[model samples]
Target: MIRWALIFLVVALIAAVLGFGGIAGAAASIAKILFYIFVISLLISVVMILINKSKR
Candidate 1:
């Protein structure tokens, strides 16, 4: 998931450099959304692991 975000970010950068404003904007937004989702999932997983460890 994080890798995909990075891919989109790179795509956005390339598109922008090529003067594709619409494509760049769309890719950037997708990347941003993916990044946030990845972060939230990571945090949730960490919290879950900590909780389980503490229970043991």
Candidate 2:
């Protein structure tokens, strides 16, 4: 997931450099959304691990 976000960010940068405003904007937004989702999922996974360890 993080990899995907990075890929999109690179794509956005390349598109922006190539003068593709719409494509750059869309890729940037997608990257942001993916990054947020990845962070949220990582946090949830960490909390789950802690809960499980405490229950042991």
Clash counts per candidate, in order, are 0, 0
**What is the alpha-carbon lDDT for the whole of candidate 2?**
0.99
For candidate 2, write residues 1-56 as lDDT tens digits.
89999999999999999999999999999999999999999999999999999999
Error of model 2, residue 27, in angstroms? 0.4
Worst lDDT run of 10 residues, candidate 2, spans: 1-10
Error (Å) of candidate 1 at residue 5 is 0.5
Residues 2-55 of candidate 1: C-alpha lDDT, one tens digit per residue: 999999999999999999999999999999999999999999999999999999
lDDT (Cα, 0-100) at 56 in candidate 2 = 100
- How far does residue 40 in candidate 2 sit from its true spot (Å)? 0.4
